[model samples]
Target: MGFRAMVCHRFSKLVLLSAAFISLVVNAAPWPDGAKIAVTLTFDLDAETIWWNDADTMTGNPGSLSYGTYGPKVAVPKILALLEKHDVRATFFIPSWVAEQYPDAVRSIAAAGHEIGAHGVRHVSPLQLTPEQEAATFSESVRVLDRIAGKRPVGYRAPSWAVSNATLKLAARAGFLYSSNMMDADDPYIHNDPPGLVELPVSWVLDDAPYFWFDEDSWNKTIHSAASVKAIWQEEFEAAYHGSGYLNLTMHPQIIGRPARLLMLDEFIGWMKRHEGVWLTTGSAVAVYVRGQQGRSP
Candidate 1:
């Protein structure tokens, strides 16, 4: 080959390599403040509302319903203490009924400087409600949360992760800054349809219900050991740490606050802290950061 032709080919290769590097720099480092990974430990504090709203309920039996009461009665304080020990601020999405029924629990969560987002009115899915009912429930959630927490919640995660087509638009109309129901992406993105509402995606893999939720009435007897769940979550966290740099772990106070499971969660948080460049924050903070990054109002 002629020297000039060979030189031209080498120049083109160099340009392509430079472009690839620039793309990596822009796309790979999405987390803020040079953090390698962003983590939000979110809890859906459904409490007794789930028992009453879900069809799987054994609500006829007081013993069956006591399981839900265990959440706010015993689990929440323990969960709060655990989070306090780690000095990690997390998010709790509570149904309005839970907040009202256990105002003190909600107050304690807020006093600890955690974010409280809307779950629904009575843990009912938006899909189960008509548009008017959904709107009313959403508004009631905002009202109760604001009343109890002393701050209006800016985030929403639909009960049971059952979001309808109107849920996002309704949340947007109600002035929510973000929704955490969708599982489409690993990273947060602004919804084009709502035109500025941020979506912090979630998945069942990262949620505790599939692994730990046991409902006798529903005949769901599967409950893995805490060690197994910890290993699964650790693997998932590592992958997120290396890939998209975002990990949102969803849990319930009743399920994860059990002694062994809570111990596992404490150990997991410690393990995560051992890694450098990890930001453990709340859902609201994540939404604000991602929105600010994308040139939108937080």
Candidate 2:
């Protein structure tokens, strides 16, 4: 072959080989074949109304009254029934205040094979607390949840999605395996604080509470009906279903317990059942899976 033709041929062959190698590496990843995505359902069981503390009392903060009005009476039961009906497991991020009020509910959740996680002592924003206060909150929350569930909570999720570096450090120091407080990535990642904690990043866009509270009218307009929410969830699931990526779905029992919104959750669970090869699990399970993969890797 002529010199120019030979050079071009070699370059094309190299490009083709590189493409094949890239394809092989991606295809050989640990996720099961035809399984592109896994989802972990995490509920923030704030249970605000159950507390007698001034800051958490129903009369003190009517907007935060999840426990007294809806949680114990309607939401928790509905959520449990829905999960049981679908045969799916989930994680409940319980504040120390809530665990103290509803020890029976915490035990029931543990018995039902779901994961329990710490969600601070009160539903106060982490950014508002000093480092010492944050550490105490973490310690107390862990202690309370462990007492109720008979197992130490391995994961933490900040109340109101408000977190700080200090909060993360405290969580790590408290012996948590993971925190869902960081929104830096779409995938699960190991965060290296001085004490080291993995951050299974959760998407706020994927959560339902913000949608309902901040943009209630817009949310109603967008989701329109139950089918709309179901369609959006399915689309997101399909997009995430091709890699060993993590999907975190966040919900508040009170917010999603309404008859209309519950229907949407039911539909989404139905769709999840129709699909095969997806690992529907709790946040702790996802954290464990990621930790296992880290251990296996060089």
Candidate 3:
């Protein structure tokens, strides 16, 4: 390589490095009440709806249904109790069918002061539906949640993070404060296709299900150790903490409910709490904060 070219490349890298450092500096604002970073722990209470359609109800294996039933009946309460013990609130995304089947579970989550968001009607992916069907499904899920939770939910998380451009717009039109399904950025950004909706990104690395949800009867059959999952999650949290950005940690009840796994969850929450300058909050609330910050220079 030519000396001049090498010199120019070095200068370019220096400029890029400087720009990156400045970007982080500008985005890092002291969180409200002097928190260092924002943390959102979200649970998808998709019990039974994952496999409880009319056909499944009539002829499905009782054992398949049992996995879904385990979530609401055994897992949610334990998760709630742990949250209650810590006096921390979280966001729970519930499919409409699950809400219909387990209204008491939804009610209990609400009564405990946790935020509820629509996850869909039958736990089906939007990609599988046409635009029209996706719109209808989103509306129906919102309606069911509003009816059962007695308040309109202001957030939406498409199951499996499966979404199309139009599906997100539908969510904005439904008046959601945020959509927690995208993975485009490490932090939140604004989505304005339907106008003024926030995107609080979620990562599979930050989700417990991808690591812990293994079933011998199905294709997914590799359960990771709780310790390994905890280690990676903490590493992600540390990066977010240093960046002074948001961390959206996703979890599912059935996946993280086992005693050993729940202990990992508990310690995760405890670790975050021990970090003196952390804001542990729900997704909707973080959306509010990010929206407020958007207008300001970052």
- For 169-235, candidate 3 gives per-residue lDDT tens digits of 8898778889999776676666645556888788889988778776656865687899999899889
RMSD of each candidate relative to the true structure: 8.8, 9.2, 7.1
For residues 170-222, write the lDDT of model 2, one tens digit per residue. 77777889888766666675554432366777776677764554333244433
Best by TM-score: 1
Write one digit per residue (lDDT tens) for candidate 1, span 2-68. Answer: 1110001101111111323331112222456677888999999987776664544525456767778
Native-to-model Cα distance after best TM-score fit, residue 52 in candidate 2, in Å: 10
Q: Name the lDDT of candidate 3.
A: 0.79
lDDT of 3 at 268: 88
**Model 2 bad stretches (over 4 Å):** 1-29, 32-35, 49-68, 194-196, 214-224, 295-298
Candidates' lDDT values, in order?
A: 0.82, 0.70, 0.79
Give, for candidate 1, the lowest lDDT window spanning 10 residues: 1-10
TM-score, one value per model? 0.87, 0.81, 0.86
Considering only N, C-alpha and C atoms within 3 Å, which residue pairs clash in candidate 1? none
| Candidate 1 residue runs with Cα over 4 Å from true position | 1-29, 53-59, 218-220, 295-298
